[model samples]
Target: MGVDFSGPEARAALGVVAPFDMELDAELLRWLPDDVDMLMTRTPFVDDVVTVEFAREVADEGVVADGVRSVTAGRAEVVAYACTSGSFVRGRAGQESLLGVMRGAGAGEAVTTSGAIVEALQALGVRRVAVATPYVPTLSHLLDSFLGEYGVSVTGHDGLGLEQRIWEVPYAATAALIRSVDSSEAEAIVVSCTNLPTYDLIAPLEAELGKPIITANQATMWAALRRLGRRPTAPGQALADH
Candidate 1:
């Protein structure tokens, strides 16, 4: 006899439109409840280098609108543009434009990674945050500016200067980076990069560092799930816990 393929039913769904090189689909799913479904799509691939030009190209309104349209058929209640650098490289106006495009393309509710980071910070009542990223200084600075636009101060920051394959960076390296960027003034640590693997690091690092930790994938999933009127499950992660 064939195995029962329909053992469980999904209660709700969230849509995600990610960058071309995103490698964290499984990691994103780990944040969802068993009864919730995630519908994901990716923008066209670009060069391996992570740069301002690369961000601009990947964030083209036409491309993102198309991506959103492709996933809307899944009946997702909310759609998220899950690229931190791409969404913020153009600043707040550009970030808002992406939402408009996604909405124009059929997304009733939309969120971007950078936008979700801000919301996550606000939800946690955090104003001063430390940042660690796998980006060149130039790309990373854009994140600082993006946060500043919302009146959030960066207490400290450090970057690994990585251009590609961010997913391969081990937890030890990321943990060390987080430690290096942390400061007494910082209420939270922000790890910017949807491609970097951070689901397992949020809780332990929070315990050791004595602050909340918000990573790209965590914020994106949290915001999307929140919009769907459901809570994300990441056992000791501060963002999910809220």
Candidate 2:
């Protein structure tokens, strides 16, 4: 008797806990190798507004713990909290606490979008960054403060001031925002917000601006895949290709 293998072998699984409004799973998948699997769960949906208060609600400790637990059953190698503001709203200490919560809830390894952004920046030896986000001014400032905690400087910043439907923002508008904030002092451009799509646009924008670009979802997936000793499938992305 004989048997044949018909499909790609599963090498590993990475669990992702996204915000209720996250619509970029396909984008995340594009970065993954065919052998790796992505298991995803979302925090409970709230009102449609995307605000600081909403980020707080989604980042509640209990919510994070439950979300981590939901994905642990799949035996994922790592669990990632995929909302940038939700993980960074409380700053560095809060980001550490989220990792603790995910670990306590059965994740062997844990990462968060904001935390991954910091790791990616450090990996590239980037110290100064330009920031762009779909959030309002207040939330944008929080991201700046979050990066500052890691000794990274936000040399330039701009926001779209959207209260909801951040995912609906097209790439052209995001590209415009990235260009507007880019400055000579910035070593990289950080596109905040996991729900904002930047997967296909990363390499081209990097060429246009002549600097590295780190987007929330890209960083989250990169940090998680790193735990598996694998690089993402992003061909020309500075952080992923690194």
Candidate 3:
């Protein structure tokens, strides 16, 4: 498992690398099972930049390569590139390219948060999508551009301008931000960004919003498990419902 800020339940064993500011140990300790062991990798970046260059740089060759190296060194069962926008911005071709690089670095299997989102959407038969992110407007636009390349139409998109600190964003704030979007025309809702904690809220959001809700962390976990041929025993909601 590649935990993001939102944390995960017990029964999952994984490592985490924060591409942004996130308190992983506290969050995970709250929910992680005692039997599961975890390691943390921190990749921090400054907030001042017009192009989101740091976010891109960490995702591009460095973070992915480093993450792959860590996974290989640990001999972990799986490794995932945890940023949704980072992987999607690289597009499908770029995702494959990164996966190849990860394999070369030492991972037996690799998956991206973006690819997981796509798989989750497709599993639920989602075509038209409404998206919300804690990213700035520029990165939000980049995400829209990336999703477009995957043949998923974005019916609407909203960004909270929270940037890298999105992990600290409260769940209520995220739910409220997502609720403000007009997703009636979309087949599903995508809350993009692993750093933002959205896993525990996925079920309630789906029920209230009346559409399948796919979050970055949830999708990434689901995809990585699928790669390991493991079926998540959790209840039906989000991608697990499929």
* Candidate with the greatest TM-score versus the true structure: 2
| Over 4 Å off, model 3 | 1-17, 24-40, 44-51, 233-236
Candidate 2: C-alpha RMSD after superposition: 1.6
Per-model tally of clashing residue pairs: 0, 0, 0
Tens-place lDDT digits, model 1, residues 113-160: 999999999999999999999999999989999999999999999999
TM-score of each: 0.95, 0.96, 0.82
Deviation in angstroms for 86 in model 2?
A: 0.3
Q: Residues 1-242, candidate 3, lDDT per residue (tens digit)?
A: 87587745544345554465544345333333344444556555646532356556667666667866764566365677777766766567877787787777776777777888888888888888988988878777777777777788999988888644566789899988888774579988888877788766877778877888888877776777676555543354656756
- What lDDT tens digits, residue by residue, belong to model 2 across residues 1-242? 66877866546889999988888899989989888889999999888587889999999989989999999887785999999999999999999998998999999999999999999999999999999999988887999999999999999999999988888999999999999999999999999998899998999999988999999999999999999788899988888766
Judged by lDDT relative to the true structure, which candidate is superior, 2 or 3? 2
Model 1 residue runs over 4 Å out of place are 1-10
Candidate 3 TM-score versus the reference: 0.82
Whole-model lDDT for model 2 versus the true structure?
A: 0.91
Model 1, total clashes: 0
Worst lDDT 10-window in candidate 3 = 24-33
